[model samples]
Target: MQHRFEDKIIDTVIYTALLVLSLVSLYPFWNALVISLNSGADTSLGGVTVWPRAFTLDNYQVVLSDPRFFRALFMTVLRTVCGTAASIFFTALLAYGLSRKGTMGRKYYMLAAIFTMYFQGGLIPTYLWLRELGLFNNFWVLFVPWIISVWNMIVFRTFFQGLPEGLEESAKIDGCSFRIVLPLSGPVIATLSLFQAVLFWNEWFASGIYINDESLLPVQNYLMNMINSNSAQEMISQLSGVSGGVGDMVTRTITPKSLQMTALMVVSFPIMLVYPFVQKFFVKGVMVGSLKE
Candidate 1:
C-alpha cells in the first residue's frame, strides 16, 4: 500500500511538471495570438495580457488588404513548392546511388558532397558566379542555388543504407533496375521530402540576398521591408490618426507590435498546419535513418 502511494505521487509530480513545461513553451504563441486579435488602441494602451482585453480584427484586415502582403505570400509559396520538389528529386537520386557499396567513383562523389558542406566559395564569389551564369534576377535563382542540401543527402543515404539488402537483391533477380528500386523507397523519400519542404518554407536569407525586385520578394523580405520602411508609418498614421508622438508614429509604422505578431502568425500558420500531418513520418525517418547498419 505504501509503495503504491509513492508511485502515485511520482506520476502526479511528473504529469504536473510536463503540464507546466508545455504551458511555458506555448505561452508566447498564445500571447501573440491574443495581441494580434486585440484592438490597436487597446494594444497601444497595453491592455492586452494573457487574454485580449478588447477584441478586434482590424489588424488582420489591414494586413490582408495590402497588395504587398499577397504578393510576398504568393512568391513564398512558389519558392517552397519548387525548391522542395527539386531538393527531394536530386537528393533521392544522389543518396540512392551512394547507397550501393561498390558503385564506381562513389568515393569522389562522396568527397565532393562532404567538401561542399565544410567549405564554399564565399558569398561574393558565389554571387559573381551566378552573375556570370546569367541567373541573376531570375526566379530560378531561388530553386537552383539550393537544389540539394549535403546534410539532407547524408541523412537520405544513411536511410537508404539501412534498407534491407534482400529487397534490392530480389528486385535485381527480377531484372528490375535502379529506377524500379527508387519507387519502392517511399517512406524515406516522404520523410526527406517533408524535411526539404520545411527548410524551403522557412528560408528567408536567400530571398533577402538574391532578390531585390519588389515583385520577387518572398514573405519574409516583404515583412522586413514593411517593418523598416518609413512610408509604412505614414500610412499607419493616416489610417489610425493617432498622434500619440513620434515614438508612437515609429511604433505604429515600423513595428506595430500587434501587426508584427499578426505577420508572424500568417507566415507560420501554413508550416504549423503541415507539421502535424508530416510529423509522424518525420519522427519515423529520423529514428530509422539515424543509426547506420
Candidate 2:
C-alpha cells in the first residue's frame, strides 16, 4: 500500500512537471497569436493579455490582400513540393545504390560526397556557375542547386544499409528488380521524404540569395519584406497622427516590437499546420532507419 502511494505521488509529480514544460514551450506561440489579433493601439501599449483586448483580423486582411503575399505563397508551395520530390527521388536512388557493398567505386563515391560536405567553392564562384547555367532569375534556381543534400543522402544510405540484404536477394529470386525492392521500403522513404519536405519548406536563405525577381520570392522573403514595409508605414502613420514633436522617438519605439511579434506568427503558422500530419511518419521513419538490423 505504501509503495503504491509512493508511485502515485511520483506519477503526479512527473505529470505536473510535464504540464508546466508544455505550457512554457507553447506560451510564445499563444502570445504571438493573441498579439496578431490585437488592435495595433493595444499592442503598442502592451495591453494584450492571453486573449486579445480588441480582436480584429485587420492585420491578416492587410497582409492577405497584398498581391505579393499570394505570389510568394504560391512560389513557396511550388518550391517545397517540387524541390522535395526531386530531392527525395535522387537521394533515394543514390542511397540505395551506395548501400550495395559490391557497387563499383562505392568507397570513392562516399568519400567524394563526404568531402564536398566539408568543402565547397565560395559564394562568388557558385553564383557565377549558376549564372553560367542560365538559372539566374529562373524558377529552377530554387530547386536545381539543392536537388540532393549530402547529409540527407547519408541518412538514407544508413537506413538502406540497415535493411536486410536477404530481402533484396529474395526479391531477385522472385524475378524482382531493384526498382521493385524500393517500393517495399516505405517507412524509410516516407521518413526521408518528410525530412526533405521540411527542409524545402523551411528554406529561405537560398531564395533570398539566389532569387532576385519579386515573382519568385518564397514565403519567408515575402513575409520579411512585408514586415519591414508594414512597420515603416505604421511608424510613419503613427508619427503623423501624434501631436508630439517626438516623431523619431515614437517611430523608433513601436515598430520593432510589433513587427517582431507579427513576423514570428507569420513564419511559424505554416510549420505548425504541417507538423501534425508529418510528425507521426517522421518518428516512425527515424526509428526504423536508426535500427542496425
Candidate 3:
C-alpha cells in the first residue's frame, strides 16, 4: 500500500511537470497564430490571448500579396531542395570512400576533416575567399560552404561500416560499383536530408551576409529584414493611407506585427509539414547511424 501510494505521487509529479513543459513549449506558436489571425489593430491594443479577438485573414493576405514574398519563397524552396540533395550526396560519397578499409590514408583524411569541425577560418577570411572565388552574391554561396558536413559524414560512415561486410563483397563480385551501396542507405539519407533541409530553410544569417541581392534572399532573410527594418510598418502604413474600398478594412485590421507573425508561420509551416512523412526514417537513421558495431 505504501509503495503504491509513492509510485502514484511520483507519476503525478512527472505528469504535471510534463504538462507544464508542453504548455511552455507550445504557447509561443499558439500565440503567434492568435496574433496573426486577430485584427492587427486589435492585436496592438494588447491583452489578446488564447484566441483572436477580431479574427481576420488580412495578415496572411498582406504577406501572400507581396511579390517579394513569392520571390523569397521560391528562393527558400530552391535552396532547401537543392542544398539538401547536394549536401547528402557529397557527404555520403565522402563517407563511403572513408568507410572502405582498403582506402589509403583514410585516417589522415578523416583527421583533417574532423579538424575542421572544431576550427574554422573566421568570417572575414571566409568572406574574402568566397569573394575571390566569385561566390559572393551568388546563389551557390548558400550551399557550397556547407556541401559536406563533417558530422553528417561521420554518421554516414558509421552506418556504412555497420552494413554486413559480405554485402559489399557480393555486390563487388557482381560487378557493382561502390555507389551501389547508396540504395541501401535510404533511412540515413532521408533523415540527414530532412535535417539539412530544415537547416537551410531556417538559415538567414549567411544569406543576410553573403547575399546582397534581395532577389536571391530566402524567406527567412526577408522576414529578418522586415522585422529588423521599418519596412513592414511602412508598407502597412502606406496600405492604411489608401482609404477606400478594402483599404479601410486593411487599415482597420492589418498591422506590421500581425503581418510579421503571419510571415513567421508561413516560413515555418512547410518544414513542419515535412516532418510527418520522414519521421520514421529519421528515428531509425539516428539510432542506427549513431551507433557502431
Candidate 4:
C-alpha cells in the first residue's frame, strides 16, 4: 500500500511537471500566433493572451501578395530538394565505396576527409575559390559548396558497413548489381535526407553572402532582410487596393511586430507540416549501427 502510494505520488508529480514544462515551451509560439492573428494596432496595445482580441488576416494577405515572397519560397524549396538529393546521393556513393572491404587507399581517403571536419579553408580563400569558379552571385551558390558532408558520409559508411554481407551476395548471385543493394538502406537514407533537407531549408547565411539577386534569395534570408530593414508602410504598399480601399484600412492596423510574427508562421509552417511524415523514419534511422546480428 505504501509503495503504491509512493508510485502514485511520483507519477502525479512527474505529470504535473511535464504539463508545466509543455505550457512554458509552447506559450511563446502560441502568443506569436495570437499576435499574428490579432490586429497589429491592437497587438501593439499589449495584454493580448490565449486568443486574438481583434482577429484579422491582413498580415498574411500582405505577405502573400508580394511576388518576392513567392519567389523566395520557391527558391528555398528548390534548394532543399536539390541540395538534399545531391548531397545524399554523392555522400552515399562515397560511403558505399569506402565501406567496401579492401578498397585501395580507403584509410588514407578517410583520414583526409576526417581532417576537413576539424579544419576549413578560411572565408577569404573559400570566397576567392568560388569567385574563380564564377559561382558567386549564382543561384547554385546556395548549395553547391555543401554537396558533400563528411559527418553524413561517416554515418552512411557506418550504416552501410553494418548491413549484412549475405544480402548483397545473394542479390549478386541472382545477377543483380550493387545498385539493388541501395534499396536496403532506406531507413538511413530517409533519416539523413530529412536532416539534410532541414539544413538546406533553414540556411540563410550562404544566400545572404553569395546571392545578390533578390529573386535568388531563399525565404529565410528574405525573412531576415524583412525583419532587419523593412517598414510597415513599405510592406503595406506591396498589397493591392491599398489606395483608400479595404487594404488601406488593413494597412492602418499593421504593426511591424505583427507582420514579423505572421512571416515567422509562414516560413515555419512547411517544415512543421513535413516533420510528421518523416518522424517514424527518424526514430528507426537513429538506431542504425547500434546493434549487430
Candidate 5:
C-alpha cells in the first residue's frame, strides 16, 4: 500500500509537470489568438488572456478585405503548390535515377549533386546571375531559384534506400520501369512534399533580393515588409490594401497589434492545416528513415 501510494504520487507529479510545460509552451499562441479575436481597441487596452474580452471579427475582416493581401495570398499559394510539386517531381526523378545501383556514372552524378549542397556562388554572384538570366523582378524568379532542393534529395535517397530490396527485384521481374515503380514510393514522396511545401511557404528572403514587383510578392514577403516597416500607419495602410468595405469597421475596432497577430496567424494557419493531413505519413517516414532506422 505504501509503494502503491508512492507510485501514484509520482505519476501524478509527472503528469502535472507535463501539463504545466504544455501550457507554458502554448500560452503565447493562446494569448495571441485571444488578442486577435478580441476587439482590437480592447486588446490594446491590455489584460487579454486565453479568451477574448470582447469577441469580434473586425481583425479578420481587415485582413480579408485587402486586394493586395489577396494577391499576395494567391502568389503564396502558387509558390507553395508549384514549388512543392516541382521540387518533389524533379528531386524524386533524380533520386530514382541515382538510387538504381546499376546506373552508369551514378557516383559522379551523386557527387555533382552533393557538391551543390556545400558550395554556392556568394549572394552578389547569384544576384548577377539572376540579372543575366532576366529573372529579376519577375514572378518566375520565385520558381526559377527553387527548382531542386538538395537536402530533400538526400532525405529521399535515404528513404529510398530503406525501402525493401526485394521490392526492387520484384519490379525488375515484372518489367516495370520508373513510371510504375516510382509511384509505389508514396510514403517518402508525401513526406518530402510536405517538407518542401513548408520551405516554399516560409521562404521570403529570396524575394527580398530578387523581386521588386508588388504584384509578384508572396504573403510572407508582403507581411514581412509591413512588420518591419515599424510604423502603425504603414501597417494600417496594408490593412486598407485588402478592401475598403472593412475600412469603417476596422477603423472602429482594430489596432496595429491585432493586425500583426492576425497576419502571423494567417501565415501559420495553412501550414498548420497541411501538417495534420500529412501527419500520419510524416510520422511513418520519420520512423522508417529519419529517426529510428
Candidate 6:
C-alpha cells in the first residue's frame, strides 16, 4: 500500500514536470506562429502570446508573393531530398562494406574518417579548394562537401556490425550481392535517413560559402541573409499594401521582423509537416539499432 502510494506520487510529479517542460520547449514555436499570423505593424507593438493580437494574413502573402521564396524553397527541398538519398545510399554501402571483417586496410580508412571528425580546414582554405575545383557558385557544391558525415558513418557502422552476417552470406551463396543485402538493413537505413535528412534540411553555411548565385540559395541561407542584413527590409519594401495609417504621425506598422517570422514559417512548416510521418519509423529504427549497444 505504501509503495503504491509512492508510485502514484512519483507519477504525478513526473507528469507535472513533463508538462512544464513541454510548454517551455513549445513556446518559441508558438511565439513564432503568433508573430507570423499577427498584423506586421501590430507585432511591433509586441506582447503577443499564443494568440495574435491583431490577426492578419499579410505576412504570409508578402513572403509567398516573392518569387525568390519559391526558388529558395525548391532548392532547399531539392538539396535535402538529393543529399539525404545519396548519403543514405552511399553511407549505408560504406557501412555495410566496412562492417564485414577482413576488408583490407579498413582500419586505415576508418581511422582517416574518424580523424576528420576532430579536424576541419578553416574557411578560407576550404573556400580556395572549392574555388579550384570550380564548385564555387555550383549546385554540386552542396553535395560534395557534405557527402559523408563521419559521426553518422560511425553510428551506421556500429549498427551494421550488430546486425547478423548470415543474411548477407546466404544471399551471396545464392549469387546475390550487397545490392540485395543493403535493402534488408531496414532499421539502420530508416535511422540514418532521419539523421541525414535533418542535417541536409538545415544546411545553410555551406550554401552561403559555395553558392554566389542568389537563385541557388537554400531556404535557410535565404532566411539568414534576410535576418542579418538589409535584404529583409528590401524584400519587405517590395511587399505591396503594407500601408498603415494615422492622422497623428502615422507610420507603417509592419516591420521587417514580422516578415522575417513569416519567412521563417515558410521554411519550417514543411519540416514540421514531414516530422510526424517519419517519427515512428525513426524512433523504431533508433531503438532497434541501439538495442545491441
Model 4 TM-score is: 0.91
Comparing 1 and 4 on TM-score, the stronger one: 4
Give the deviation of candidate 4 from the true structure as CA RMSD: 2.2
- Give candidate 6 regions above 4 Å deviation: 240-253, 291-293
What would the per-residue lDDT of candidate 3 be over residues 64-113, giving only the tens digit for each residue?
Answer: 88899999999999999999999998898899999999999999999999
Residue 178, model 1, lDDT:
68
Which should have the higher lDDT, number 1 or number 2? 1
Whose lDDT is higher: candidate 1's or candidate 5's? 5
Worst-scoring 10-residue span by lDDT in model 5:
284-293
lDDT per model vs. reference:
0.77, 0.74, 0.89, 0.86, 0.80, 0.79
Return the TM-score for candidate 1, rounded to 2 decimals. Answer: 0.85
Please report the TM-score between candidate 6 and the true structure. Answer: 0.90
| TM-score-best of 3 and 4 | 3
Candidates in descending lDDT order: 3, 4, 5, 6, 1, 2
Poorest stretch of ten by lDDT in candidate 3: 238-247
Clashing pairs in 5: 65-242, 65-243, 66-241, 66-242, 66-243, 67-242
Tens digits of lDDT, candidate 1, 151-253: 8888778877877888878778888756566776666676777777777777777777777788987887766766676535554655565555534533443
Q: Give the top-scoring candidate (lDDT).
A: 3
- Among all windows of 10 consecutive residues in model 6, the one with the lowest summed lDDT is 244-253
TM-score of each: 0.85, 0.81, 0.95, 0.91, 0.85, 0.90
Candidate 5 lDDT by residue in tens digits, 172-279? 788875656577677778888888888889999998788888899899987887677764456566555556666566667778888888877777788889988888
Q: Give per-residue CA lDDT, model 6, range 1-293, as digits (tens).
A: 99999999999999999999999999998899889888877777768878998887767766787788889999888988898888887787787677779699899889888888888898899989989999888888888678787777776788778767777677778888676666656766777777787788887988887888999999998899889999877865544334543211113445688878888888888877877777767767776556564
Clashing pairs in 6: 40-254, 41-253, 41-254
- Tens-place lDDT per residue, model 4, 128-181, is 899899997797788989999999999889888887788878887888736776
lDDT of 3: 0.89
